[model samples]
Target: MNNTALLKPETARDEVYAAPLKDLNPAQPALFQANTMFSIFERLRAEDPVHYTPESDFGAFWSVTKYKDIMAVDTNHEVFSSEGGITIGDQPMEEGPLPMFIAMDPPKHDIQRKTVTPAVSPMNLARLEPLIRERAGKILDGLPIGEEFDWVDKVSMELTAMTLATLFGIPQEDRRKLTYWSDVVTAAPGQGLIDTLDQKFEIFVEYHAYFTELWNQRVNADPQPDLISMLAHGEATRNMEPREYFGNVVLLTVGGNDTTRNTISGSVLALNQNPDQYKKLRENPDLIPSMVSETIRWQTPLAHMRRRALQDIELGGKQIKKGDKVVMWYVSGNRDDEVIENPNDYIIDRPRVRNHLSFGFGIHRCVGNRLAELQLKVIWEEILKRFPTVEVAGEPKRSYSTFVRGYERLPVIIPSRL
Candidate 1:
């Protein structure tokens, strides 16, 4: 029996509300609507690779969904400038250019990135690996085997927070404050944090005041080998004003918190979803590095990066005027069929995993990509060695913000010991 034929006239109308695929036009609200965004991307990747989406809430923007198109925009920083800011929706806060490095176009972006890049270099990350592993083991050791726990809070957030604390040399007691400031700064209106622009700006002011004290202390004290000290003493960074200092602090806070948190939470979710993949890694411990890359690709935590058109440019036969906001959907790009073979499938040893844009591309590519990778690798390596099996105990809940796609809560149960 055909279900469509069996449905009554009224039921058919109800079906219209349920089926997003029924609305195919790019201009339709369904394109930018949260419920339909992913589905729309899947459809565009199959049909129209570049689509224009206009929304009352977020304003009009070109959604670059395909792999090649996203790569073109992300790598060509000259044509597409990040200085316009990266949020897709209207920012409630009214302030001057917030002075974050991610919001600058080169050669300024280059200079700022170079100042902090050395601190997260492979050699530096290598020195931190053992410490990261020790922290991971300590966190996992505290959990009772075969008992359900919120993995997002207990494992993912804790690990990333501790790692960031180590990176910045923040006191352990103050680490949770880092996570709070990060949430407040990046939280959107719908996320249940501060709703208005004034509140968000006020939060920023408070954060700046706190960091000012920290900065003063760091400035007068003997120099140490941490991100804060490096930024304080680095040739390009020493001259930064209070606003600029706060901006960099906010950048590192969000970067170290959200990306690695999602990676850790997403990896556990991925493993639980694909037990075969989990079993594969458990059997072959050397696969941790590949697994790390695959996790970043599968998660694509930084869902999209926004850019402003510097000048008139034609992409995919569409002419974009200067100052037009263009959003590169890295989440969709990672799953593009042309870039990764069997893009949607989770293959731990997939050879092209590192080619993913989850960390992004070109000049603004993640400044701490190596550190993020090191943290994930160390966590997984230590986890596999300590526990024979770790499984999801309940459905994972996602963060509300589209900008930072991650698990807010993940429940899991692990074996007592190996």
Candidate 2:
């Protein structure tokens, strides 16, 4: 679909947000293209925080816009079930239920989640920190000093892919395959990665076979510290069905890839766009942790997570029927003025910095969030130690999906050293 056509006249760009609440459709790709998603979210937060869209390419769904409502829905997993799926787009029925823990309800979700939590436990992150700093240093030291480059490619994806490879115990030579499969998992046809469902399926089969080989290698070996090993030896996860195993792999890949990579890219773009905040960070390098939190909130790597109502419920003055699709717009929630002071502004020193919906809320919140934050913090620390200023050379090209709030490319130039 040509989203640009939805915006008939570029002259009326301002009016896009002024459309009636009932007529407003946040799912249209044009809003993100115009970079006017904030305005739509602003309107929804004020007038219809729990707004419902009757039609969309995905389906009819309710949009939960405010931070409070999003939290309410997110935390109450029993009432707002995740069993249907995490994103708004329903999985193709022919592919069967990808029973990854993220989409499971209750005992199963808890069990599978426990199996992998140790990989990201505080002790593990502490052990991984020095290695992350080493990798970050090397990556930054290798960047071209004065020439323009795609920050998303040269830095963001590279670092995240390297870290993911470490987490999965994938051989360094074969690590790029993880990145390839991760992109394919979230990509829609014509999204610049895969062009058709058949191509996607082909890649899916390849991904499954590759992981199966890894699983076989680890299933019999002495227990290791990697994700595949954890799943292989875990009492709860060891006997998972084929589709369930594939689903877990997809969950870990997409979860780990999108959050960290996009934030890395988004941090640069955000700081560049907000020069004052950038200046503040350079002056006080200690602000990196706060800046990381603010960037995650501002970027909202994943835009929304969908839920299916298990029972009829009333929320935000609207009645949601049983089995209705409800989407918690984290992008919108992070910018909600009632919750976040100066929500539109990117302030690295903002108080209560961690108070945002980026990592999500409740039991289903991202398990790898601390590791994601650690990578961002370490990269920024290394970036500041090297370049005094990393300038945005051009506008960013964002991912086509409303689900992944991220960049496909971010052009940047580093102006000498500090």
Candidate 3:
């Protein structure tokens, strides 16, 4: 929680590796915020791939690092259940869980997930592309040249907010509220976003009330392309309990926001860090699709997804007891040397770039993946057409949460217009 005063890289790595394997805990939000968990995950992947920490901010849980091991956990939804929830930390006991499809199992998860899938289907995305490109162009055109600006705020968030508003059928004017609610849902107490868990609930109440009005409106009207209308008209989700609706709302908002938003920021930062790859992109624009996938692998926006053990299982030679929390670090798995070649470097044109753990595997794979790619592809295409270069002018401030691996701010400069 707000713990990243920005640790020195060498010291952070040394401290993490020096600690005993038994005492290592990668779930701490501070490690993520400081961007120091790379070393922790590195040690865990090397020594204890299926690691258990007796004590943590979230309590005793198992960390599943490495590429193949993460795939095993993510794909085997039956043995590694999502019903216990998809994050290492438990929700407030009083609030209970807001049940969304991502946290459900089997028949129920399939039904609810199917209800909202059409809104982001390939056909719908093709229909939405021209509009998205137009918006991306407008955003790029509006950016001030020869001055430093936060790409996260001025570009990444704005573009994603506009696209999210279009998908949810909300006014573009209310887009920032979507960002706020999404942030609050992932925020921890004392993280600056929220002071306490109660405050988070209060924001949830506001979020619920706002979205409920939209749901009622959609339910009363005929079916349309927006997500609200789909949920209201779909046979499975039409009569969902109010809290369940809110849960899906939370899910969709974060789903749409984080992957695209963070990856957009990450793409900019990564390209800046590796100028050679950025130069390759300038010479060959066709690499955008491959570059998008590379950045997704490079970023792994949502770092980890948690699952619960259905029965006692031995994974990577560790005995995982029934009901234990198993956290699959997708971020770490993307870095496993045995799987991805030159895993630490940002290579935009890497072979089999799409074959990464960023969007996950199996049934729980991200629903909005293609749309995320479409947005990135269009933005980069438009970006190349106008600006010669968008340079990262200063260091980025990463988000506070362990769940959302994203930037709070990334300052950039548009040196000139093409």
Give the winner by lDDT: 3
Please, what are the lDDT tens digits per residue for candidate 1 over residues 306-344? 999999999988898998889888888998888789987
| Residue-wise C-alpha lDDT for candidate 3, range 1-418, written one tens digit per residue | 1232344677877776666778777777777777888888888889989888777778888999999999999999889999947888877737587789999998899999998898888899999999999999999999999999999998899999999999999999999999988888888889688998888888888999999999999999999889999999999999999888988999999999977999999999999999999999999999999999999999999999999999999999999999899999999999999999989999999998998998999899999999999999999999999988899999899888778899989999999999
RMSD of each: 4.8, 1.8, 1.8
Which candidate leads the pack in TM-score? 3
Q: Which lDDT tens digits does candidate 2 get at residues 84-152?
A: 589889776475657789998888899999999999999999999999899889989999988999999
Clashes of 1: 0
My TM-score estimates for the predictions, one after another, are: 0.90, 0.97, 0.97
Q: After superposition, how far is residue 367 of candidate 1 from its true place, in Å?
A: 1.2
Model 1 accuracy (lDDT, Cα): 0.79
lDDT of each: 0.79, 0.88, 0.90
lDDT of 3 at 185: 85
Clashing pairs in 2: none
Supply the TM-score for candidate 3.
Answer: 0.97
lDDT of 2 at 39: 63
